[model samples]
Target chain A: AQSVTQPDIHITVSEGASLELRCNYSYGATPYLFWYVQSPGQGLQLLLKYFSGDTLVQGIKGFEAEFKRSQSSFNLRKPSVHWSDAAEYFCADYDSWGKLQFGAGTQVVVTP
Target chain B: SAVISQKPSRDICQRGTSLTIQCQVDSQVTMMFWYRQQPGQSLTLIATANQGSEATYESGFVIDKFPISRPNLTFSTLTVSNMSPEDSSIYLCSVERQGRDGYTFGSGTRLTVV
Candidate 1:
């Protein structure tokens, strides 16, 4: 049984500020982690994924995440936040059967 | 990656009525999945549809409530039988492609049961 935990329920950041969303997972083996973003009334879009990589994986929309095995974390980060970046983000892990287990999700609010 | 087209986009149905959601993929895929997102919540896997076989449902989901059909590699349908207000949620279709770590999702079908 694999599970994901997102510590933050909501986060508000100013435009041009650096942002990081925390994600931790519980998996027995090497985990496949992913970050996804969804705007209101829209389907989810993949931000990035980590399978077996160079620790740091870059994704679309200038987002990046680092897979830390020691801490069991894959946190999403952005150098500068934009107003358009306001959306709900989800962290997920896949089981051996390829079923996705998602975190509760974190809603990001970007302000000018 | 595969692109999915799902419909009807949104529907308001009465209690006890059934709704069938369709998912069509642009490219053939090995696995087609169904998910449900309750209000302000994360997505929960409903079932996995495999071509030429029966759908495998997750825990807390039963085939009697959610009947799924995968006629081929690129198309599937999920029907919510004997729906209730608690069944009001966004139903999504997804496909996994080879060599991709992530799954591509359809723009979910929002079902509002009254």
Candidate 2:
């Protein structure tokens, strides 16, 4: 079974500061990694995804993620975060049946 | 990305009752999935709603509890049967769009059981 692990339960960052959220996965074959963001009481929005191209994939909202096969990781990063960026971030991978297996999610808090 | 919508964005139901959540997509899709997000927990896939076929449920999930319907490429529904306090959670419907680029999810139906 494929699984995702987001190490940070909650992350606090000052506005306009750099941000990075750690994510690790456990899978036997090549993994299809993704990052998604969710606002309070809203649906999830796709951040980025890594399938078979360049390890570094850029996504919407100035977010990006790098997929590292060796470390079994695909961590999300952003140079500067705005207050609106505060939300829950989830890392996910595809299962054998092509269904998604999601991480516990990392809650990002932007401090002014 | 695909535009998605879910009905009854939220509902509070008495215990032992049932609620059906509807998911509508703007275009045809190959795969439709139902997921459950418990309070403060990750999204747990409930089933894969395939068009014209029975849904495939995940471990610990039964068809009797979560009956799903995928009538066509752009419409699906999930019914939470015999609700309980434990059933209170956000139920999301997603579609696999653009040949697996990513999943586009509905706004989610927040269910509260009392």
Candidate 3:
């Protein structure tokens, strides 16, 4: 079975500080990884995705993710955190049927 | 990127009632999916709505409980039958754009079964 794991449930970081959210996946084949962010009372917005190209993928809202095949992980990273960056982040991978299997999600709290 | 519109943004329904959520896409999509996100939890796929055929439900989900309909490539509906307080959650509709890696999601319908 394909599964996604987000180790951190909640993380707090100061504004202008760097951020990194860890994500790991369990799959037999090459995974199609994605990162999405959801603000309170809003819909999900796609941050980035790694299908079959470069390990480092850039996404909207100054977000980026690196897919590490060796570790079966695709973690999201940002150089500077902002107050608007406080949202729930979700990591996902596509299953055999091409349906998305999502992680438990990590809630990022940016403190000023 | 595809845009999705979902109606009934928030509703408080009585137990034993049913709620049907509608999803409309700006463009024709190959795949449409329904998902459930419980409070303080991750999103769980409910079913894949296929046009012109029966919807394919994921494990732990059933057609009778969460019936879905996809009459065309750009529209679909998901009905939560015989709702209970346990069924209170945010329901989202997603569309898979062909050749796109990520799916586009709706604003979601927050259903509260009281």
Pairs in clash, predicted candidate 3: none
- Model 3 alpha-carbon drift over 4 Å, by segment: none
- Minimum summed lDDT over a 10-residue window in model 3 chain A is located at A25-34
Error of 2 at A29 (Å): 2.7
| Model 1: per-residue Cα lDDT over A20-88, one tens digit each | 999999965978899999998999999999989599999999999999999999999999999999999
lDDT score of residue A42 within candidate 2: 93
List the DockQ of the predictions in order: 0.85, 0.91, 0.89
Q: Residues B25-79, candidate 3: write the lDDT tens digits.
A: 9998877999999998999999999899999999899999999989999999999
Cα lDDT tens digits, model 2, A1-112, are 8888998999999999999999999965878889999999999988889998799999999998998889999999999999999999999988877778899999999999
Per-prediction share of native contacts kept:
0.76, 0.91, 0.82
The stretch of ten residues in a row with the least summed lDDT in candidate 1 chain B is B95-104
Native contact fraction (fnat) of model 1: 0.76
TM-score of 1: 0.97
